[model samples]
Target chain A: MSIRSLADDGATLVASGLTSLQRAHPDLVAISEEPAYVIRAGATPAKVALVSGGGSGHEPLHTGFVGMGMLDAAVPGAVFASPTAFDISTAIRAAHRDRGALLIVKNYTGDVLNFSIAAELAAEDGIATETVLVDDDVATDLQRVDGAGPSQPDSHRPGRRGTAAVIAVEKICGAAAEAGAGLAEVAALGRDVVHSSGTMALAFRACTHPGDDRPAFDLGDDEIEFGVGIHGERGVEVRPRAQAGELIAALTAPVQEGLGLGRGDAVIAIVNGLGAMTGLELSLAHHELDGYLGARGVTIARTLVGNYVTSLDMRGLSITLVRATDRFVELWDAPVRTPALTW
Target chain B: MSIRSLADDGATLVASGLTSLQRAHPDLVAISEEPAYVIRAGATPAKVALVSGGGSGHEPLHTGFVGMGMLDAAVPGAVFASPTAFDISTAIRAAHRDRGALLIVKNYTGDVLNFSIAAELAAEDGIATETVLVDDDVATDLQRVDGAGPSQPDSHRPGRRGTAAVIAVEKICGAAAEAGAGLAEVAALGRDVVHSSGTMALAFRACTHPGDDRPAFDLGDDEIEFGVGIHGERGVEVRPRAQAGELIAALTAPVQEGLGLGRGDAVIAIVNGLGAMTGLELSLAHHELDGYLGARGVTIARTLVGNYVTSLDMRGLSITLVRATDRFVELWDAPVRTPALTW
Candidate 1:
């Protein structure tokens, strides 16, 4: 039997979901449907506005994180598609204050292109904008050729596919902006977070699109799509299904190595559910990851465990580690009040 | 292919999960291994403590709700099982403060029996206690005789199975207790919330237990288990798959009628994901529910949309309506600091 979800259809999914999200958090977020974006509802103090968006289906990634102490606005496209540059530009114009705005874009071709164009569009209207590109997925980092020229075809080395680490980028950078950091300062902070983070994921089952009859991919009984991304796509390789410890290790060791984390290095860890993974499973992974890191003499300064970034309803999870400085830890602990994240 | 989850063997799932949970939210909660209960880590104000728990699958329910402005202690049983009376009494003793303790027990035979015995045990130790039984599920409301006698076997009429409404009860009552309500007053408030609440759930697919090859049940592609419970059991009836509005109406009308909700009646609405349901689906359901209620002239005073209570990874969602009084709304808006819920 095919997996099913309680969605009307793919075409209207994003609009309808935004309506509900705005209704559920009217005090926190407001929806603008003409250009299609969600902005903070209530008044915010004058600070650099934080705006981010990509595709829909990753609920709470951009929209759900729009509230006080987070994004000032979020532009959402249809399910798994990039928001139009016009939509992003309109949201930036509407959300930016005198301090201007910062655009946090995930490392995907369409997202980078659209967000960059929107930044220029906003700048034409006298709105100062800075972009922080998030490309923390270690899975896609393998194809990076040393000293590859900029002329190389984009497909050959797309850089790392951004994954769950965007949560860290958006959260920490949003905190900095909320603290009245200038646009350049906030962008610098976001880039620092992106630089310090790495993410890896695996899926036991693929996600089924809304109204579709079958999942995006299939897996054997004892196989896993290791190093999966956030678009219901298969992973870099197939691996035999093993114990939870081994699976978590496979995802975590690379992230730690990529960040050059060592004994006594503190980090902010995220055990993010792609979509269909349960809190029970995610918790087990975090516990195992904690034990693994502790054995490696690493200290987990803070942790977030939830479906922050999802790939529709894929049954898997990702591990993100951001090497945390005292400032990052302080900002991560800062108060935030969004629909998906709050403190 | 059989449904699979990223879990260890079934026997150690809860323990392993808790270790990770405590690791993730060390500042918010602490876990006791011997009795397997989670309690607020730091000192809480002297007041009537709120203690709750049930089987482990429905995470973020009792355990995840344990922290400030919510559950004081949560005694988790193994997956789909009940904690022993000894476990309940120990948690009660540890959680109770100078004011006493209040046991928030979901309406399951195992849960009721153990909590009742634990209350008595606590009384013997000079610890005053009260119990507020929650039976908000309308599915099992069938077969409940108007004036069933005490001698009637529970099997014949188990009444309603408590589901997602317990979140409102725990949250509202926990706030009251935190604000220094006595045990009797807190218990009375909890009972009022329970009496004012009703929940209905449906599943597109049944949940599979960890280490199990098959699911709890199966459904045809065009069928849904209407009025399903949180334990992954079949619903009260099988219904043809319909559009989102019709499915939502089917779930909401009964709940509205059961609560005697009419024009001008206000409510706190919840679109709770059973397990695998995505936030996209939940948001659409909430939007539909909101539209349905608005057309009927009822105002939704507050809204909560997420997987607050889940039945493992069941592909389903539940709707809960708690008739909102001003005091209930006030308490609902109170500050809370838990891992799963914070504001």
Candidate 2:
């Protein structure tokens, strides 16, 4: 079977999506013409500016999130590709106002290299910056080498791949910065969220890239790619199709174990769609996840179920669990007014 | 190719989705166990209560929309099926106060019959009620049938099918009722919204029913079903696939003419995802649509781009346009706190 995308041109897809986003949310965000960055529209009390960006396909990730109580600026690259170092540095300089800026980079090689280079460039431009690298996808934590914690860099291990846990990091750190936290404190808080979080995904059908006629990968009728990444990459292993409850358990177990969650542990859970997954499916998956976690005595303090971080039209979902502290729960409950997530 | 659903059982899909929805938004909605209806939670002043429901697949429609600024109660039936009159009546009694109630019924045979019956049953229980029947789908306005306006129920025709325009009716009417408007006024506003709105859809792929292995129908790779409905039904015609701009124009032109839109007309535009269409695709489609409307001298007063009303996993989107009035814009700008729509 041939697959197709509504946006036929990959080169123009991000531009069109960004323009439409700005048009729909004129009050919340504005687009810079050159190098293409989304900036928070309305002015507010100056604090540590929160900036983030990644590949274009996982929208609402860095763009739809540029608004009050979230990202101050977001730079989007081409589909499934990292933004240029120049784009990131420009956004950081544009958003920072003496309060310094914090860059939330997902732990992809391209994204990390570009964001780190941008930080150095921003420093040369007289702007101080801190980086919070998110590596919450437990799928990449293969082998789990000694001292290979969420923040530790291990050359032998590729380490964790960032997935939906970035939502928790952005939300919590955004709340902290909005509440007047300093740069160091906000970065520290973000790292804390990443440390307590873990995510894993599975896809029965991979996503077709814009302008492509076939999906990135294919699977058998009764099989699924477990522990998949966000860019339509094949998962770590193939598993036979199972019931929704079993699938939920399969994704949730590793995250629960990675976080060392047990009886009386509180968590903020996110049952996120990887594009084609419906709200009905995500909610049902959440029901299964909630039940499983309850049976294990892990209390859910808050929950989010939707297509927040998607991989084009990949037909799958990821579960992210953040072992919650009182501060985390309070920050998560704080008022947010972003285009994709607001309360 | 076979399409699979995350939820394997159609019988329990609605229940699982609702349980998960209530769990996620406990402060916003509560599930009534017996007949499985979702009702708004939290205390509020007595006002005309807004209630609406339909089949389960078009989610975030009646259920995800149940909150402070939308439906007071939402009764979900099985996928692609209507709730019984008993379920609707129970929900009405549970939600209505001394100010009476308003039932927002989408114009489907089963839904109209059930909601009308429930309205009568509520009357027998000594509660005053008014009903607003929404049928804004221009695709179903076939043959015109001599004086078949949106609200007119001609015996000779099936009448226009209700589509995403129900979101406008429920939202505007909900805001009106929340502001203490009487039932008659709320119902009138809903009907007015229906009269001004028009919607059209196209699908490259059909959705599979929960637990089904195959899709509702099949189509060639280069053809699309134009003017499709929310129940995964076939469209009015099969048309050759075109570029994004041309496809957007194909859907928008008719709705523009159907509403008699011309220079200086303002509208509230909704680019609603049927289900599996990605946010990137939807936004890019919106960009083309915005350019098309602007070239025609029509202005978009407000825009909503998301999957508020979906057809499970159909890979398509519907565009809805409601000619804007001062009151409509005011009400549209009114604060709404629903699970699917909040600002």
Candidate 3:
């Protein structure tokens, strides 16, 4: 089912792209043959080095985020695939100062297993490592049936999938770490950010995998996939497309309830484009969501609307709400220079 | 024909969204009843105030760019429509502070007329105003016949259409102005940036005008429009899509030749998404383009790959090559705190 890519060599293409990015910021970044990259200035400034990675498709996620006040290093795998434990361990060693290292991992089966293994390997090498798992996707909160083979499991919480909220987590933890917080404190701060945030996404169309002709999923002209996953997995519902207000309501209500946000609460509202959504569309969505929240008496203290986290070329969007504390807001506003999210 | 949007009130929605942005950086931005907004920090830091605006559909173009080291004020019209002379005059007055004001305008008939009129009005009010017109689109470099009716005749150069390269112009001029350059000096720098740059765009799909179900143009499932205009105008050619390398070569060759970029020349390669193209696709295009230019021995000194300038929801990419002077590179790397292009 290989479709076509601009380059038949996917890894080489990604490497070259990353090289171009590194060239853009020669003073701040460096790439390595370890199939990893490290943000140079971050190493000496922090007590705990933050390392994060997963697949390469999520550009600007783990990689674009490595900078002065972000992740110290990022180890990228193949598109939609997890990096090897050896590569992760090497990234840890490369980013490690005298202080310990902290791994920020998304909640995926392969990522969890590999990152965990990398932590163990790092520990054996005398580097103390801690991990903060981000599981903020509210869409996957549905119960799973148990003992139904690999196809289905009943009465089990499969755990929330981490989507765009990892960016918020990284920003807060990176700031805390840079401010000289230890590994345990940084990890605790990351956990607090995750617990206060929730995300929901929907896609108008499915994304095509590289070298694959068929889409990862399908939708009719009049239908949209609600609660869509970043990897193009089937959503919880496939419903006829609704108007903007209703759609915004549907997406935001669950997130509000999940975070227990209510009247007079301040929040950071992030309207994230999942790849191909236009800036106009994201802004319009933010407008609608802002109105919805306002009518519900919630105060949006901070807002970010952009394609921060995406699923290849899928035409969709995800909304993330993080309940803001004075500390979280301070960290969020701290300066960090990354390839994608800056200023 | 128009396609449905999330909000029926486009103006209201846009205002709300901008309000949310203002809330995000209350210290740096403010909205006014002047039917325009001004970036507060830029006003006091420089001599000549940089002002720009156009239609609303182009999100983050004029508005998102209003901040430190960029535009001082931005006045937006309705979607794809030019701002009125009155509003433009107001923006000029609001941004003016003993220093003159410079308007950065894209070369479209409506925009040129309106900005020119506003400059005249500002002059009447004892304000010195200058304009830098951007006309870098090579797609519109058609032979114009003299003495023909509005519809026909040839032999006159209609001039190139201005597109994404306006960003380069704004950034350089903004930096020059912020550094306390005189109005003429800033204007001259803008002219230099525009003269040394060119852009070409292609769209995989046409964006619908809001409120219409029909697309602006038609293309077969396997076809794409080459040399597309940002306002959803028909391109010069429509052909079945080729592989990534062939497509990228087609797009980059014209821009390279237009800029007269040769071997050993350093250039900034900007692969901008026209709204809905995914980051992966844009990166793939950049990879192919990097190879194409490398084969020609052109050194890509810096690379910016993102949806910076867009035609809303149009699934396309535009390649802009700016011949880099040492000054250009310095300004490009200069810190800008805009909602869109911040680094």
Candidate 4:
């Protein structure tokens, strides 16, 4: 018997996958490029409608918050591809049927360029469109780390890579929207989150398209890449794989350095799976996380341990630590529901 | 160039694993085989203590729920192996140090036998230990497919397995303990859950131990075993691998027919990973769950889509459906704070 490829968006896979997802979790609604969704505020007519999208793969970041709180509309791109410009603009228009729409764009070239052009076209059509780029990944040099041996922030120090920033932005911005914060507040928080965030990943092997069976590259049974991205992007280092403690240290060095966490400052840790890693493994990584942070005398006030954000089926973990001020912790606790995430 | 093992308690995996589990998720804790957990309820002495344990492999179930509105103590067995009578006895004695204790035991041979012996031992010391067995797998035949379909209960039915029963019992009994339900009520509900519940698993291949690189069994690249156990038991059927939908249908048929899930009845589906299955796979299976339930006319009111209960790095999935009533739904909604699970 031949193995049915798991990487696909054919009606069969989508339909079966949705059923399985729903069966496993009733709260999540697995939307596809089919029968798109649009969001708008109830009761009072809201002043702003926000639209964001890329693909069916990047889940909770875009669609998970498409309730009355976060997004007015989210245009899902094809799996690792971009959504059509028309789809983006149209979805924005639908969500903005009452309020003017704003586009929340990530810093990816394709997403930025496409959403930016779509924003312009939507603006021409009389809808207010503002595009914000979330270049939160320090892995790609998003932030200048403040390095003092995990003791101080240095603008000149090498920075950590980006991790778990989208979660903070979507969650905080979504809460702000629910509390009637203006577009300025939402966009500002989004910007602040990106500035403070960093992520880096290592793909043990590359994932091919749905119909493809063979993996892109093979590693020794005991090999792992470092500083990789979710889309099968090669890592900064392709050293042999080590234990979770070493892996967490490698991932956390940049984060702790970039943020310059000290003994008193509190932080939130997100040990995210790149889709392929098991939740058990995700749970298991927490061991490395607490030990590393505690040994350095860092305080972790709040943590989200699970696959809050996933990159298809990439086999890796990304650590995103946010400096937890009182306000950021409040924002993290604000509850919003979507298919990929919930309170 | 070294491998990690669970045996070395002082090793990095053990040190960080325990630290991470405790720090990030405080609800989870490792009690000495003695099960010494301090509980303070308001100002009054605790009235009843809930104690549960089996093996360490099932994370959130017995251990994660030890924080609040759940178990007061959870003694863990090694990896996929059973805890000794001493561990169970110590946990029970400690929990009963100031109050009576209730032990929620899954219907496994080692667990049942050991917990029973411990209960008897506890009784000798004037501490009462009530044991409830959860045996909910309806997909496998203790004998063969010739066994009863879902219609018959395990005692009468032929193929009874254990998978999703952990969640159902945890939900029901956790709520009962929260509501101050008596030992009788908690035990009764636990038994009811095992009686009403059913589970089946599929494995792509057998899992090797932590230090072993190869699987215990040899399977073709495309082959997967159906009706697999959590400890990598031999599957009842080893046919050519099929689509997730077809596999799900095969898994569900025994339970649906045995339980008689008519087109009009409501149910809850749990698509669990047998350790190594990826979230992408779970999400894809989740897609299939809705369609399958809808086709059978089984209204799925509640679904949990994750690796809530997993086998050790086993690449398989188990589908569990509880015959839903208003009560069961209410139980599921009841809030319980555990290390691995929460509402």
Candidate 5:
């Protein structure tokens, strides 16, 4: 249930928001009237079109990223709901050039199914397409057991859920594609990015649904959920809240271990807010994470700290670390002019 | 009380966070060792330097904006407290070249006094300096009488509290300075920006100080504070909470009236979050404001919708509308590469 929304108008809210964004950057972006994909108006068809989308709530993710140096088109559904195959197909058709289109899909059941079907539909229309799945959440790295000493193999769990690391993938892949990389090369770069990255999130409070009055889940005054998914899915564990340093330590340990980062390993760190966290709090958390990683001998080569990817009004944050090579660093620093991620 | 922060150490947290930011953009920014102003690393002495700063809690406002195309130096004090005259003086000395330094000071009492003294100190040191005062908050537009309507004129109150519109002033003035405008010209541009802009903010919830457990203020679940100041000050009035559209209408009316803008006037609309508000909610507010302005026959030339300026963890938003001319629009669109407020 929404504690701070104009109830019962989530879809209209999203569409109108996209309209204003397009109006703001008319030179770089446009919104198609039907099935409504925010397309890059000035995107040159020199390389493969990079298309990504999902639900509406995690804004500035796919839609805010559609511009010259980022996504070619972004397809949005109703809040937290997947875009239909028809909508995705329409976006692909509009964005497809002579090169091809690459679909960047998060590892969600609905998104995977719908985007795959859209890819098939595009292929039938003679527009070549490929999909790169991003499954970088280390919070769901292992499955939970009923009552034993908390030991379950990774294979026992469903695949890790995708989170903020998708932004890193899109950015690097966007740069690669903008430099005229072919569809296969862009796809491979995205895959490599996914393979080299890990993210973990924790929720301080649950987000209320747009039209609902009750929160998606309840939390005690002194409790926090660790390894929380972007949606209201229960985290791997809930515990009495710890200090910011302790929380960062717990969060970064899993990510560092998963990425196998050690002393002298250069990496890009993103401390992303999951909506409703203060910039001050996020910076404080970033401070703690920096010290923790530095103490462990990891070289923090680059950093992005903000509310880039969000879960509506959920009061939490996520951390993503991408191991950086010279090529990746160069690509990361390349100029991007998007509504959300820009430099 | 802080519901989400680790207790205490606000100053250390800020310092460490700034260190991480400096590490991220080594080529663009650095923090001075003694007084700790975030300074642009590669600033050339060819043009007048633009400098701004205030308190610490407002991340990215003064510091995050220190980079190539925005601020030459940003001096941060403790959270929600003003920087000392010495610190501002140090920043002025460091940033001043033969072209002089322009100080962009928000119109808080402490900030005004300290920055003014700093200007005097800089003059004593033979560095030509000018100050541009921004007082664009329309929420504090008129003085309050005892149980009466807002009949008192602007002079009767403690002047309008500066808020988010300062970003507009800084950006435009920074551009003007970068284009080799003299100190007087840059100062005039900033004053014009302030005179041509108005902002009003509302809060759904109050933020707690980092070292405190109690919130700065409190509101009932069904109420909101309108015309709130950025320093957790109580608003001009309290009202029953309304839907998103109604809230936007309430916030935008004062701003539109204060700016005296109507009918086909081009404007840059900034729907800024006061921390802890979701992008979904802010975008919704922007959508509503866009419709409201369009219905009034106003043309939105540019739009910036995000948590650019914040009030710690206060869950609310502010709307700033800058009446745009060709020059203002060009300056707004000028490339900026700051840690925050970049394009």
Candidate 6:
């Protein structure tokens, strides 16, 4: 249900969704409707305007945070697709009350390309712009495709793969913007948020987008797929489904090893829902995580387990680990007034 | 876990859970720590202190609402059982700070009996007390005996169910307190909230309390128990699992009929989670609801679908419909912050 696939009828539905959203949240939508869409609490322009958008389905990520502390304006795509270059440009234009705009994009090909084009358009309009791509998903970074689907020999690379890390970017960048940081500093911080926060997911089933007649990926009823994307894309591991705790352990093994988290090291762990898992399950997963980390001698000071970002109704859970330095924790604790991430 | 089922080892884990909850939310735990406690904001004595409680597993319900604008205090039982008479009586003592206390109990047999005893104790202490039973669940009121290790034919009755409608009482009651409404008026309003609210549930599985390792009732993997209660008690219809939309309609049917929702009717529908559904799934359910009501020619003015009340990790959902009048909507819009039900 990307913008590309959004036909006249679907656009009307999207319009209806937007209308419903605006009607339900007039004040929130009002903030987004501002001339320079970011409402920074005063007439004074923000030194750095953090503008971000990609898929439409990832809610409260950009739009919900468009207030005093977080993002300026969020351009939404239909579902999992990237927003048009025009919409991104329009959002940039609307948010850049200051001299520059900072764009945060996921590392997906369409999102990166679209944001780059938007930045170019913003530059033409004399608004300085910078872009940061979050690539923190272990599965994608280690992707080695051999001849047989995901079993390709070269399908294993070791690097950052992005998942729920964009949430961290929205939070940190939002706080940085509110703190009146400059464009360069905010852009750098946004990149760092992406650079630091990493996540990996395991799906019991694939997602079916709106009007999708079938699932995007096939998963046996007894088996689980590890490292699937938010779009229900296949992952690195398609092994037999293990016990819930063992499943979490397998997902965390690569993440913990990659982060080099030692004994007594404190980190911020997020147990995110791909879509279908309940908060209770997420909390249970967190309970298991506490034991898992304890068995590994790791210390976790702050944790959040909920459906922050989703992959349309996919039945899966992701383990996101953000190395919580003092500053990162401060950013995390900063007040946010989003529709979803309220505190 | 129930207090009875807790062996020394399991009791330790349960205690640890409470400890974690207390540490994470001190103000929230203040209501629970006292076993039964009262918290008043204003210096002036109120007419009736509002008190509510049930089991420990349902977070934010009885405990989360304790604050200036909500419940004076809430008593906690172990898991899904009723609070002890002593605990309820103690809470009354703590809450009877010159004003009387009103005990709001859901229509659970144990809760009714326990709170009634507590009320008698409070009256003996010269603290006047009133009790109101919330029987909002449209589902069967009693447990079904499979083979019945013990036959209790009189207990399990049909047409008794409850859900998040209790949240409305905390809300309206809080407003009543703010408006300095008298005890009679508040009591009447509390009853009105129940009268206006109708709830029905669909369980994916059964609920098991402490001491009962087995579910009160069991369903096959492909089964969906309609008209289920919070306690994982048996439901009315044990139908095979269907699509989420169909399941929601099944639950909403009783609610719509009870509320007498008509075409062009404006209503506030809360697609509440029984225990385990994620917020995202609830939102998706809301989306379905909007479509359902739209097709039915009903106009939904406000929708608050979330895990307002839960039944441990029971995988189920309940739909609570409060036939919306403009006044209730305003009351809902009224801002009052508390531990869980913050505006």
TM-score of each: 0.96, 0.96, 0.93, 0.84, 0.95, 0.75
Worst 10 residues of 5 chain A by lDDT: A142-151
Candidate 3: tens digits of C-alpha lDDT, residues B301-343: 8888888788877878899999998999998888887787777
Model 5: docking quality category: medium
Between candidates 2 and 3, the lDDT winner: 2
Candidate 6 lDDT tens digits, B219-274:
67567777777876666666765565676676687778877887978877777765
What is the TM-score of candidate 4? Answer: 0.84
- Backbone clash pairs for candidate 1 read none
Q: List the residue pairs that clash in candidate 5.
A: A1-A209, A1-A212, A1-A213, A2-A212, B1-B213, B1-B214, B1-B215
User: What DockQ class does candidate 4 belong to?
Assistant: acceptable
TM per candidate, chain B: 0.95, 0.95, 0.93, 0.85, 0.95, 0.84
Q: Give candidate 3 misplaced runs (Cα > 4 Å).
A: A1-13, A33-43, A143-157, B1-9, B41-43, B142-151, B154-157
**Per-residue lDDT of B75 in model 3:** 82
Candidate 1 stretches with Cα past 4 Å from truth are A143-155, B143-155
- lDDT winner, 3 or 6: 3
Worst 10 residues of 3 chain B by lDDT: B143-152
Ranking by TM-score: 2, 1, 5, 3, 4, 6
Q: In candidate 5, what are the lDDT values of residues A157-257, reduced to their tens digit?
A: 45878889999888999999989999999999999999999999888788777777766888876778878888877777776767788988988898999
Task: Give the higher-DockQ candidate: 4 or 6.
Answer: 4
- lDDT per model, in order? 0.87, 0.88, 0.80, 0.63, 0.83, 0.66
The better-scoring model by lDDT among 2 and 6 is: 2
Worst 10 residues of 2 chain A by lDDT: A143-152
Best model number under DockQ: 2
lDDT of 4 by residue, A1-343 (tens): 2223333444344334433433443333333335444343233246566677765554444655565455667766656556778778777766664445657776666676678778877887888765656655556653213231233446754343223576676666767766766777767777776666666555554444455555445555667766666555555555665666777787788778877886877777777766545444565666566667888888777777666556654556777777777877787777655545545
